[model samples]
Target: MFAASVAVLLGAWNNVVITRLPGYPQSYVPVNLAATGLLLAGARFAGTTWQELGLERRRARAGIGWGGVCAAVVAAGYAVALAVPAVRPLLADARLAGAGSGEIAHQALVRIPLGTVVWEEVAFRGVLLAALLRLLPPRTAVAVSAALFGIWHIRPTLSAARANTLADGGAGLFAVVLLGCAVTAAAGVLFAWLRLRSGSLLAPVLLHLATNSLGALAAAAAHRPG
Candidate 1:
């Protein structure tokens, strides 16, 4: 338990550092992958596997199904929100477009891409979640893991708002924090639940990877450059 907790904290700290580094978008992929790799490797070295972690196939299947449904729900909800004028604009920005509005171009750099998705799933959902499950009860572990995952986004949210913070520090930061927590907490629970039930981590990973890919595509298509 102690060791697993230590690993989780280390991963969280690594995210803190990685997300703050220059060229964050690129840096995050490798750093997050590496941390996840180390945790999984450590679990194997310690003789822990899914079976050891209490991941029965039956229960894991339930988790995966529920997780997939939740992921679908979130995606559908976001799609609906984007359809509405009031909130669609919040997530619109050309920076994400990366000079590629063409369908082929947008298809090129979708969030998780095919090649890297598997590796990331192996690392984050597979390794880290398993480690947490070993250290905590299945339900508790999933909840904590989800919360941690949500908090990981805090740095980027704040960094993106540096100017706003400079203009209105506490208010801007508080708003971002509140917003981040609410959204990521829901995402975290869904992802974690999926990971727990699937027992493969690939399910939630694919679910997330697809969300990033399709959501980005949808966002790009829905918003026009102003």
Candidate 2:
């Protein structure tokens, strides 16, 4: 939880600054290094091998298949809901403006280097999940991880939306924040489940990559004026 919190905080800070700053913060490099170092350090201290963490080399297909399936589900779910009138309003609201800017910003955000994604999955789902699995029951570890994931996003996302509202008051923007959080929470849970089932962080990382890449692609496609 502590590591995840730090990662999220770093990401949030990076998100806030990237817009105004001339150069994007090279966050992924440091985050990946730190996460990998920390995990290895922990394993060394615990007198355990990589295989113990269930990170032993497995059939490549297992990772790809599991991750791909989960990613497909999440992406398909979001895409199918595009036609839902209620969903559109909740996602954009007055604060978010049209989908164009949102998509552009989202694409920029997800381009945080694939290495960072691997580190995050390893740290959050691999090392952390393994620790929690031993300390708590399987179900409890999954729930706690999911909950943490949700909480991690809340601060940055809500802060961004609220800042927009404060700069230019948007009526009922808080409702949009609430709705977005709920949707992300659902995603978090599903991602956690993928992590648990695949028995490797690779699954969640691939799923994340797929979702992010698709989102960015879709957002770019939507940026064009009809």
Candidate 3:
């Protein structure tokens, strides 16, 4: 329990760094990598084997395959959402409004996949979930870890809402946070399921990569001038 608490605290710190850091392009890689290292070290200190953390190679192919299926389903949902006019603007990112093709490509292919996706899976599913499983039932661990994962997004979601003015004021911001947490917690359950099913982080990593990359692509597309 102490170890799990430490891990969760570390995750909260990482979230602060991720959302509060300046010079995002310059700071993101180093910040996330350092956080990943801390999570991995914490996992080891908690007596978690690399394999148990889903860091093994034995089921690589199966993990990737299952991840692909999950990504496809998510992509299909995004497509359907995009088809709705009201939903389309929600996908827009003002930051990407003036991004060139190369910038968008780098964001989708490199920045997101290697930076955000990898570190998040390692911290949330790899370390936190592994620790929770030791202290709680599998389903319970998944739920708790997923809830933490959702909570981890609080800062980012609030930052985005503030930047986008998605809400009217304080009450609207509160509602947005609640809604975002609920949705992300549900998504976290799916991610946890992938990790448990494959017994590997590869599956969740791939799913995350697909979700972020595809979502960035959609945001870029939406922000582009007609």
Candidate 4:
């Protein structure tokens, strides 16, 4: 219960940082690092081994291979989505409006992967999932962690919608948040599965990086003025 509470609080804190720190994007690095430290410290306090947290190095290569496969699948799916006229507009990102190709590349290839994905995967799949497993079945732990992961994206999704002017009213914003949560929860299950299957956090981290980076690239391409 203590671990769960801490995880919830930390998740809320993460939401605040993600939504409220737009003007200070650089602050995300240190804030995420601090969150990672707290999760590691909590794992130690709860007697969770590094191996149990999927921090082992032995299966890293296999994990990376699987991650690549997952990434390819995601990229293909995004391509299909982009090709579909109905779905294409939904993927539009306002952040790309004034962003150069270099900025988009950096966001996709570097900042998101290192600054956000690693910290999130470490916290949710690594530490929180480990904690939950001690008190619940494997599947239950995954579901719970995934649910929290979905909830954690609420603020960011809403914020993004507002930034993009995608939502017109409270109802629209609510719908956007709901859809974002559901999608993220589904993705979280995939991430949790990768963590369990590979017995290493590396797989999910790579898969996540691929998803974000490729998605960003696709969005940038779509929004680029022809």
Candidate 5:
């Protein structure tokens, strides 16, 4: 069951990257939802409970509260970035530029949370982390899951960085990919820590949503005609 679960997860993930299916930035909704369902099923079959999956109802309130605070902080940070000329580039990712207002709204409201956040929180912080904890120590589980989460971003990183023309030759692109992966891996560790601290996936989900969704909105604002 463990091996099957791993294979299924990896297969689904690879397919998403390889296919660039239906289309991206939004196409991932069904793909992630399906992968999430399969992972949950495999996890349950292997004796992992919903609470172990980081859906603990008792912790939900605390998680949501903490998450909301963090989300607000992120929003304020983005607001400041938008206000400042120097730091605005931090919010204005070139790869996400040129989007229409409707497209930006869809990305922030629908695609980001549903396509990106939901399944990711459930899969990494929820399923994989719980499964690993059953077999390994808690720290080791977090490390391994965080590492995998980082690796998961490699392809997407390559695609986005290329779109932004962030690097030049092959070696430069390789360097960019390495740097991107390293950053995401670090972020994964932080997200994992938040999951461990809150004991409910809501905390990380809201944080992730705010980070991506707000950034998308900020990028659109930055690129808007002035």
Candidate 6:
């Protein structure tokens, strides 16, 4: 199990770095899909069952009900955040500046859900967490998976830091990356908890969609044309 988990994490790291490389497929949707397939195949080979991996159909109703509530909360939060004068600037990420509606729609609807959300949810909250639960207590499993998930984002966070001036110098960039890791780690815990609580990936999947996709749309809306 340990070896399988390690291999999956390495594959994820590769995905993170490679997908961002020049000449890589745009949106990386196919990459994520392929990675997800391999990850699930590897997990099953390691003896993790669908139920253990949070794929229980019986849990779907609970997942959807709670997930909808959580998603609504997230949407309301984004709406509030976008409405605030001081917070509007934060929502208006400069990276999204001047993006056409089509581009933003692609990002929020297609790129985010398929490219970013699906694989991570499946890998972290599904396969990795399931594998860990077999070896550790529920809390420990969530923590380990969450920590690994956080580490997995380091390369992307570093890349993002380089794209913006928010991280001043080397030290500032380091701080930014560190903070990003911490924030994502915490998010990992939330996601894992949701997965465990509802016994279905649908719970975390819906919440993740709301958190990311809606946030992207909110950011685009908050952005004012100069």
TM-score of each: 0.68, 0.65, 0.88, 0.88, 0.90, 0.91
Which ranges of candidate 5 are over 4 A from the true structure? 1-4, 11-26
Instruction: Identify the superior model by TM-score, candidate 2 or candidate 6.
Output: 6
lDDT of candidate 2 over 117-213, digit per residue (tens): 6555665666666666766887877676666555555555677577456334454665665665676667666766776676666677777776766
Please give, for residues 55-102, the per-residue lDDT of candidate 6 as tens digits.
888999988987899999999998888778888777776667789999
lDDT score for residue 213 of model 6: 97
Model 3 CA deviation exceeding 4 Å by range:
19-25, 79-87
- Candidate 2 yields a Cα-based lDDT of 0.58
Output the lDDT of residue 199, model 1.
58
Q: Rank the candidates by lDDT, best first.
A: 4, 6, 3, 5, 1, 2
List clashing residue pairs in candidate 4. Answer: none
In the range 115-186, model 1's lDDT, one tens digit per residue, is 245444554456566666666787777676666666666764565556334237688677877686668667
Q: Model 5 over residues 68-186: C-alpha lDDT tens digits?
A: 98899999998988888877765666766777778788889987888789888888888888888888898888888877877788887898788788899999999998898888778
The sequence of per-residue lDDT tens digits that candidate 4 reaches over residues 8-73 is 675686566554765467777766777688778878887899888888788788788888788888
Q: How many backbone clashes does candidate 3 have?
A: 0
Best-to-worst TM-score order: 6, 5, 4, 3, 1, 2
Report lDDT (CA) for all predictions.
0.60, 0.58, 0.82, 0.83, 0.80, 0.82
Model 6 — which ten-residue stretch has the worst lDDT? 6-15
In terms of lDDT, the best-performing candidate is 4
Q: Least accurate stretch of 10 residues (summed lDDT) in model 1?
A: 106-115
Candidate 6: segments with Cα more than 4 A from true spot: 2-17, 20-22, 25-27
Task: Return whichever of 1 and 3 wins on lDDT.
Answer: 3
Weakest 10 consecutive residues of candidate 5 by summed lDDT? 3-12
Weakest 10 consecutive residues, lDDT, candidate 4? 14-23
Clashing pairs in 6: none
Residue 87 in candidate 4 has what lDDT?
78
In each prediction, how many residue pairs overlap at the backbone (N, C-alpha, C within less than 3 A)? Answer: 2, 0, 0, 0, 0, 0
